[model samples]
Target: FMNYVPDMQKNHFAKEPIMTPPSEVFVTQTIYADANGTFHFSLLKAGQWGFAALGIGEQKTYKGKALSQDAVIWVQATKLP
Candidate 1:
């Protein structure tokens, strides 16, 4: 559990205002994708869910160092009435 940490100068889109960072963050779990590049998680609660795909892109290096083309997608779920 910690406050949101902004990306460093190494980020490719450090200047873009795509979205605002959360005030606080918590990592509930970390799961890796399978050989087929897929993962699954059971939504046990009804709220916003964030799926972060880290280092899953073809571009893997920058300035002779490793880089990550990370992505995030949020989903909202509702229980059946």
Candidate 2:
């Protein structure tokens, strides 16, 4: 089973992109970077998963920008390991 949150809102304008859980579990992480310089990270477990997107705009303007536009996300699962 999988739970997804589409069209999420941006919280703090300057927060690093990271995902945590209520408890630790085995997971596989995959990262994708587009030609536009945007990055997407996904975490997959046994039956649960989550994702984070980052837009490191311009590749030159790096001053006070949010590492992540959305709020920190957390996923929990028992079958992770």
Candidate 3:
């Protein structure tokens, strides 16, 4: 299970479709806010299903750094046949 916390203050866009099947499982990316209020994008899922959450404000930290300081976002996915 993957716990993905996002920043709500910042807009988030999924590269792939939200609802998908197990075989059609695809990877998606979530962009974070940049220094100028912009967002830096990235890829996720890779090819799987689980759950996630999204909100405003910086919640968790990663690699000795804060995930976000404006908002937070969460996402959840499931693999079906």
Per-model TM values vs. the true structure: 0.52, 0.24, 0.21
TM-score computed on alpha carbons, candidate 3:
0.21
Q: Which stretches of model 1 miss by more than 4 angstroms?
A: 1-27
Task: Give the winner by lDDT: 1 or 3.
Answer: 1
Question: Poorest 10 consecutive residues of model 3 by lDDT?
Answer: 44-53
Model 3: residues with Cα > 4 Å off, grouped in runs: 1-68
Find the number of clashing residue pairs for candidate 2: 0
The per-model lDDT (C-alpha) reads: 0.65, 0.45, 0.45
Measured with C-alpha atoms, the lDDT of residue 30 in candidate 2 is: 49
Which whole-number lDDT from 0 to 100 does residue 29 have in model 3? 42
- Relative to the true structure, candidate 3 has a C-alpha RMSD (angstroms) of 13.2
Regions more than 4 Å wrong, model 2: 1-30, 36-45, 55-68, 71-81
